[model samples]
Target: MNAPGHVLVVGASAAGLSTAEALRRKGFGGRLTLIGAEPEPPYDRPPLSKQVLSGAWEPTRAQLRTKEVLDALDAEFLLGDPAAALDVERRSVSTASGTTVSADAVVVATGITARTLPGQSGLRGVHVVRTVADSLALRSALLKARRVVVVGDGVLGAETAATARLMGLEVCVVGPQPAPMTGQLGPFVAGHLAALHTGNGVGLRTGVLLDALLSQDGAVTGVRLSDGEEVAADVVVAAIGCSPCTDWLAGSGLDLDDGVVCDAHCRAAEGVWAVGDVARWHHQGLGRLLRLENRTNATEQALAVAGNILGEDRPYLPVPYFWSDQFDVRLQVFGVPSAENTVEVVEGDPAEGRFVVRYDGPRGPVGVLGWRMPKQARLHRAGLVDHYTQPLEPTAP
Candidate 1:
């Protein structure tokens, strides 16, 4: 509570590193220990599915903290060792390597792992892009395959399909959702994305269930849909998304909903805080606990938690910004635009590869989504950060 006797951070990803920095910036010059499951130091993950998988970038290229920052902050870095369990009563944690650590305050930012297809483990040419290892595996498979089948239409899946297309590997995307990014950008914007991917030589099939993998000699060869339709493929990638890495928190007494349930200030329980995908934090605007698996949510919550630890009263309210790079088009969204609402096409055109869509709820101006027109998306993000309670003044009635 009082600048923390010692700060222990679990997970050396964006959220963990950001928390350490936020604490130091606020003059919390106490002991800082950061641990991660990966062998590498704290790094960014947004590029893992894009440039890193495309072979144009490396994981270290996405590092959020430099060696100087780590040293100056007096933070201990524990690489290749994951925090296995929390000893809440003792204010300590047990690591996978049998290491124990105790602190006055602990931040849990373990995040989530990729979800794979049901019967994909035995198949040789199957991959899921969530970590550096996953990206490397998928890249290798893409290089050797003549054709690839991608399941799920989330951000990572679409990006993988786009990367495969860039590498000249024919790709087909199968998803039950009507459009890509439907949960964030809403269905109207997602419908336009469906057209974009379809027009780009990537077969976009919506409302289909990718049930099973067809294999020959324990290697992936094709996929069978729930509709009894079989698709030929040299490789299959299941990007159905992620599951929170909170299995170890079972019976820990911390509220565990979809993730480690926390308050607006990122407080999980008595002496713990939750940040990133591992946190189900209360969003005042949405009036519910939200577990956002994105860089934006992770970084913001980390800062909020650090500040709160240092006796700050500011509650974290993220503006909600996310973007995706598929082929050459960049889709950006800024707000919680419910997919069930009516949409008003604002500017640009999806057919021309650039546009902005405004989601209209019963009260009006629920959210905004855009593709290619980055400047437009930025304007919407500014509105959100500025907390635009009402729609912008309409001109000339």
Candidate 2:
């Protein structure tokens, strides 16, 4: 394969920008264009849940790069208009603003959309924290909010709850998981998170299902649980989860499962590739299809896709990584840790609010977690490399 004459990236966030940067770094002098759904330039999202929401950092501080740096790329940026359709055979995309972009190669990096609860639309005081605007809207609502109910127990939910609590608002986290991030951190470690929230004056209402949004005069007043319990709230943040932004790619002749299904090389079609949260590609090392929603995966996978686009032909198998900051705790995770995997304390002690944990799967160490002990956890992360890189027996066709 040879480098294409022009590459069109279909999203203008971290992943899309990273791809364009990687392409130029690899000596690609071809035409490059990035299509963004939002009007603003690329910015970091992790801060939206913490620094931005908590008012510790201004919205401008979240920008990924300065204007001077972005201008150096020599790329055309089509912002404020979202991609509406894709012609896979022609390697072109149509935008919501009646503009069409064609290129020798098309990279899909549309990312994911935040999931909202039923009847949340057109309702006041309901918010999500996927973008900067969302964070600002949530912060505005929090200023007048006395009680906030966060609907989810994942990283986003816990972080939002912490932000709200620190803002002097009564906060309660509602979710089906037994503890915060139970699905990602396992029971042993998530227990500490539960304690952290409780110790911070954040209420925990787990192991329950949300039935409906209780509203009065078109403003959300509270959330009703499936077990006939209701939690009053002046503001609601639905951080349940997200789905891949593939609606525009519908009927585009590409495999679309949980995301844009791709090969080991991250190629979805003849001239099409995908990166970031919207890409569910075959991980050769893991012998399965994997899609990661974390920021680290967005940039790392984009670099791999860029190399492959420039004829490197490398498979994009990587050790998944992500981090979450709530209160004073910085939780870093390497590899995939599941609630099903058994956990063992590798270093430090949980009682001291600093420790490292190892997740053991059937084959061996699958993941390493760092709770306020980033250095120790990173050292232990070396043990997971062998398990992730080991060749596995292929399944019979």
Candidate 3:
């Protein structure tokens, strides 16, 4: 495999597209092919649950509208076809159409798949908001839905519930965690979020697993709660989580625990590398290997991997960040905040639905998360570093 050889990219999300663009910018004129499972082109996914649900944005607008960019990059588009398997030994990828494309370097950007609940097989009004198709389906259902049962209170579930409430549908969220968004925001902030939703006419049930999807005549009617209870619903949306789309990498030598294991260079196993949601890449600066199921990470990791593929030596070390727009609140997060992490009120107030929480490591501020304060978060994003200390308040703007 040479520096400029046949480069096959699987998945057409942020990662794949960014990597292809980066490769071209790095002067790579290799045979490039980008494969996607969706019929639509690579689109921004954050709006699928919010603006698209409110009919403010259309599905067509979400696509990566840089056709000229891709054309100039000289990359072939293979939309709606998924990579079936990776023949790592032969350095080739097999597509669903039985087409095996031989390549010198392969970048897997297969993203993630939405996890569905048991007995939720029959779908008519039941939905998951991970893809454009899923959001479009749920938006149509919300037009007539009176109540919604959202299983899992992650950012996706919370956003869907908020959207349902905005659409005048009564919403209820059921999750196994004690508080909403605890996985990302921790207990203190999730408590405030839970309170916000419940106050806005949302029924939130924590620590309850989903039992079954109630259906009659092959159309979803309601949901049966795990603890012998039922939620009245015309729509049931499961926002449990996503599974890494590395099923095609099975038997490949790529280190796969939860996803394709890679270093900061995004090198997985042998001539193969992975990025985006399907990659668990090591960050040299952080001294830890982690995977981010975020658009920002997907873009950054893809570019960094592309640079490595083009013979650059820099390792990926980006500030992990993600955001959510729900109801009247705009949420932004930087770094991972666990339950044990010391949380301090860095700016604003939680009561006002605006605040920035700083997570302190043993040495100093390791991460910062905020809501409705883009300006502060922007400044704090640059301020945070390993062994960096942030005072309770900034030095006056």
Maximum-TM-score candidate: 2
Candidate 2, residue 359: Cα displacement in angstroms equals: 0.4
Tens digits of per-residue lDDT, candidate 3, 1-397, equal 3595789899898899888988888889878999998888789888888888778887778877667765777788888888998988788888898888888888999999999878777668878888898889889989987888899889999988998898898899999888888877888888888888988899998888888888888888887777878887888998999999988888776788788889767898677889899999777666667888988988888888898888786777777888887677787888766677888988999877788888877656677888798778767876565432222232355
Per-residue lDDT tens digits for candidate 1, residues 1-397, read 4567898999888998899988888888789999899987777888888888888986678777778867887889888998888977767888999999999988888999888788877679988888888888888878889999999888888888888888888889998887876876677777777777887899877788887899999988899888888989998888898998888777777888788999878898777998988999877665567788888877888889888988896677777778888877887777777777788767887667788877767655666777899898677555454343232334474
Distance (Å) between predicted and true CA of 111, model 2?
A: 0.3
* Model 2 weakest lDDT span, ten residues long: 386-395
> How far out, in Å, is residue 217 in model 2?
0.9
Select the stronger candidate by TM-score from 2 and 3.
2
TM-score of 3: 0.94
lDDT of 2 by residue, 74-184 (tens): 999999999999999899999999999999999999999999999999999999889889999999999999999999999999999998999999999999999999988
* lDDT by candidate, in order shown: 0.82, 0.94, 0.83
Give residue 26's lDDT in candidate 1 (0 to 100).
84
In model 2, the runs with Cα more than 4 Å from the true position are: 395-397
| Clash count per candidate | 0, 0, 0
What TM-score, to 2 decimals, does candidate 1 have?
A: 0.94
Instruction: List residue ranges in candidate 1 displaced over 4 A.
Output: 382-397
Error of 3 at 355 (Å): 1.8
